[model samples]
Target: MSKEILTTKDLHLYYGDKEALKGINLNFDAKGITALIGPSGCGKSTYLRTLNRMNDLIPNVTITGTIKFKGQDLYAPSADTVQIRKEIGMVFQQPNPFPFSIYDNVIYGLRIAGEKDKEKLDAVVEKSLRQAAVWDEVKDHLHESALALSGGQQQRVCIARVLAVSPEIILLDEPTSALDPVSSSQIETTLLNLRHDYTIITVTHNLQQASRIADRTAFFMNGELVEVDQTKNIFMNPAEKQTEDYISGRFG
Candidate 1:
């Protein structure tokens, strides 16, 4: 078995007075892909955001319990939000590239972190773009505005932006929902390649996509974790009736 790089224990969350997550406990393996799947409004995305403390941005949000990355409590008062975000990056549903050049977009995080070396920035741009599987397509067009690229290209650029920071984990929230079928396939392929270097935890509504890319699958419903198991088991022989029902399309 692989090492557990991250773990959540009795995690709970609330947005204002409504409970959003109900005691979620899950472990993420090092350099592996874990997919969170559920029906609409099931709190899977909420749980994903909590891993990197992204939920802190919401008003009247409260979190309890613990999220530990390599044995350190992520919600501790001394925990650094900026550092946590640097080590655990996120890619949202839409392809939101900055209005800057492709090269500049990739290096945006590094630049903000005060990396002033042009040679280093150039090297990271090439490496991150290659890791995102977009280097060959945009190598010669590095100076072109990222906003001018296709949606798929722009999403890949976003992924590259996250990768350039050398993060240990990448959180994806339905990253391909806005993309075309071909583009979605390409993004899936890129994610497969990325697992060799980064631990990935993604919230995906598409069961097929989750089965295709994840080593482990976690099912959530009504703000509670219903089942979690190996991908094959989760898809082929889920232990819970709820999981089977969801997978079989009886109900979401």
Candidate 2:
């Protein structure tokens, strides 16, 4: 059995008077891809942010419940948010690479952490780009502005930036939603290859993408998890009628 890397119990969140997440309970395996799918405003993205305390950035936001990472309480008063974020990095929906050179973008985190060794930074940049499957395309253009690359390449570079930090888990929020089919496919392939090394959790609107790359799938509706199971079972033999209906295009 796979070890549980992250777990949530009765997790709840509110933005002022309105509730966003309603007692979410889920566990992520140490290694593999888990996709969160649902209609717009279903709280998948909000829940994803909660895992790394991203929601803390918003005013009037409040969270209640236990979120544990590696058996340590992520919400504990003593928990270090910066270290948590470093260990559980996030890739946003858009390919928001910094306006810096590709090499600088990939090394930004390390530099911020006080790493100044030229050799180590060079090695990490190359290794991360390779792991993100965009090394060959960007190797010759390492000094070029990241924005100069195509959307797909920029997204991959962003992924490399996250990998350079050597996070134990990666959170992707609709990562391929802004890309073309070809670009999306490339991102999917990169994710598939990364699953063996990192625990990945992604929010996606494309059911096909979820089925193709996710080892497990969780369906959410009205801020509540409708069902979660193996990808095959979730698509072929879901236990919930709502899940079946959504998967069959009946309703979201």
Per-residue alpha-carbon lDDT of candidate 2 for residues 98-158, written as tens digits (9 for 90 to 100):
9999999999999999999999999999999999999999999899999999999999999
**Model 1: per-residue Cα lDDT at residue 152:** 94
184: Cα error in model 1, Å: 0.4
> C-alpha displacement of 42 in model 1, angstroms?
0.7
The CA lDDT of each predicted structure is 0.95, 0.96
Off by over 4 Å in 1: none
Error of 2 at 135 (Å): 0.7
Q: Candidate 2 has what TM-score?
A: 0.98
Q: For candidate 1, write residues 99-141 as lDDT tens digits.
A: 9999999999999999999999999999999999999999999
Q: Which residues of candidate 2, in runs, are more than 4 Å off? A: none
Instruction: TM-score each candidate.
Output: 0.98, 0.98
